[model samples]
Target: MAQNKLAPIETSFSKLMGVQYPIIAAPMFLVSNEDLVVAASEAGGVGTFPSLNYRPPEKFKEALTNIKSRTKKPIGVNIIVNKSNTRQEGDLKIALDAGVELFITSLGNPKSVIQDAHKNGAKVVCDVTNLEFAKKVQDLGADGVIAVGAGAGGHAGPISPLVLIPWLKSELQIPIIAAGGISHGGQIAACLALGASAVSVGTRFIASKEAGVDIAYKQAVVSSTPEDIVMTTRVSGTPAAVINTDYVKKLGTDLPWLLKSLKDNPMTKKYVVPLIHLMGMKALEKSATNPSWKTVWSAGQSVGLVDDILETAEIYRRLVNEYHEAKQSLP
Candidate 1:
């Protein structure tokens, strides 16, 4: 189906993905479900979800089947190609056999994934934090690179999109897809102007109707300001941006000094994030009454831009409308 209320936004990335809009509803963990992916594709944008969201391996294929049955549009899946995720190869095999259109690789070398995906006529884009990694993936034959910046939700990079997007665009021949702190159409417009092929939006959609999180989680995304978002490596040992609820404030505080303390204490150093989850997040989530203090949720700095909950299709509609308005307003 096409976007009926607005004209299509064409870009090299959108054309490659066969989506009408120059947006990729970024693959999110825990929040993205089949409903969200289908809605995004039907709304004229590429929709994607993390393969890790499906557990027990069998369910992953079931998810792919469900999404494919619902929509014929091109869709994507996120795969963590790192050492910690032992299931990477298995997930990659299932995704390839399912004829997944695109693969978004993160954390580790995507060399093998790019080769296999391309052999199956699928495309691969790597999530790169810096120019060194981006250039390496391009040389490995990745179809594109997603420039993840500091303001991104999970394992965010050190650079800003303002620097990363243009830097990758100038240095790499492959398309550069900008990610981090992008929620609104104007922000998307700014990325395009900065030489991004398209913008991969993650956080804003967490509040959408199709996201399968608790209503309280969605509400947190809506009500929180940018100041409520903070970056800490405490939860997962990776620098990730998250909503700073009372629980995180109390436990995940002043991460640098705490990290220093943990590193010196060999007994606690190995335990770090997992030990904290066992001590804090798990306990609060199971027994707490205050919704804000119960669960730690991931969100980008764009939480400030997300003010309301809407269906995924509605979110795409409003974004396209806003993109046009922003473009027209520019001199």
Candidate 2:
């Protein structure tokens, strides 16, 4: 594949991923499907899908095949390394066998995956929320580290990018893709100036036309404010930003009570347990009525800046223009 080049960002991220932009769409759970991945790739940005999104290994392979058939641009698959899921090795094998161009690992030692990816001529990118994790991933031979700073949608770093980037830049030699709280081109330029080679965006992309999120969820992303964000691990045992919906407020007032109520609720056994595979759909449906939007609709504080739901192409154009403008305005 020919290297697609960009000037606003100097790192070989675009070349490395064969995309025209350095933006990698965060591997949003449930929201990252073949359509979204194809759209983002077509728009010059890399799109990523969480491996677990496809429950069955065969389904994961099907997704890879579908994405490959859709676009020539680079696309990535995220192998989550959390305690809840240990399908990293199996997923990596599937992705590599499918000729996956890029691999992004989160929550685990990427050395094993990096080794295989490099052996297969694939690039490896790891997501890090703090300086320690950033240094850790870089040391593991990852091609780059995704600096997931504060305001990131899912499991995120609480520190500011202004502080994390310079710290990582001073210590790490690999390319750093700054993430979190980044929505506009100006923020992207700021991250680049601060030593980030590129940027990764999640919440902002969730509201895009290419995103696979429900319409009500998209609307929540578009109309949300920074203050409307609440970070909690009550839902998934990892800190994540979500809208301050009724469920959030309820959890705020009494999480234990809510959990107990859920355990006691008849719906838990009937719909939640029996129909576990449809949880994503049920979550989206409940989010519309859950009042807290927090039960399932996850976004970031950057939602305040995502006023309009545009096509992926328009989003890329806006980001590129803002990046140039910010660079020109720099003293």
Candidate 3:
């Protein structure tokens, strides 16, 4: 695919983000890296990686510099805005200074982040699971909202995109990026028709060549179906969608009362929750790096639609073609 080719589908979000396609390679934790981000941007969509992917502030700035050197296309960074993210402010400062123009805030209130981002001449988009949160972010001056509905990979929402996207569009003036159970061009077209300004794709990108996941994980995504996906709260304090490996299956779906209390109670959370979150992080890290399929593998219900591992550029091309074809087939 030609890097300069304009996408057949266009939207205000695409224009605002300076991308050809109204698509964002959702900032998948650990999985999204500089290579994937560059590939997605070069392929006409925006790409983002989690801020925590780079540990030290300096390292994160270095990665941002590298991404800037590679492509002029727009890219984004995801920040976990909750109390647990002790490095949030520092990371945001580094990214803003490094000229990152788009910030995606998740897992907490984005009001402060939105203010800072706007001050830096950047845009803030918040990941929201429900209408109330979506409206909250919009009121805070968010540039957009990503509706992370049920069936999305990683920490997913309980609502379905079928219901969430249109409702958010009807209620909010900001652009709605529909996420969940979207993999094919037909699904992208459907989302666009549903009043979404763009679509956020996660699981589908795991199979892309530029994704940093293990080859085994990519193959698992290709071979598995929606049945292989399960929701487990064991990986983190919150519910997350992960592949059902034997190891994952052995873990409980809910935390114990004590752990749950520590995770939820503000007073206890400061001391206890971080330790629990650390243990969970270690387990996930081991699973993602080790050779065993028994380890935790994250994927969404869209895994059923993924049939092959292809380059990120190729994936974008196919999606564009598929979207056009689907549109033509529509009555």
Candidate RMSDs in order: 3.4, 5.5, 1.5
Over 1-331, each residue of candidate 2 has an lDDT whose tens digit, in order, gives 1123435354678777766789988888777888888888887888888997787888999999999988987889998665345577888899999888889888667788889999999999898877777777777789998888888887778889999888888998988899999989999988988988889988888888877767778888999899998886555434667788777777662235554465458766333322332343355446634434355678888998999988776777778877888888988
lDDT of 3 at 106: 92
Query: Regarding lDDT, does 1 or 3 come out ahead?
Result: 3
Candidate 1 worst ten-residue window by lDDT:
281-290
lDDT of each: 0.84, 0.78, 0.87
Which residue pairs show collisions in model 3?
none
lDDT, candidate 2, at 281: 38
TM-scores, one per candidate: 0.90, 0.86, 0.96
Q: Positional deviation of 156 in candidate 2, in angstroms?
A: 1.7
Off by over 4 Å in 3: 1-6, 264-266
Per-residue error for 111 in candidate 1, Å, reads 1.0
TM for candidate 3 is 0.96
Estimate the lDDT of model 3.
Answer: 0.87
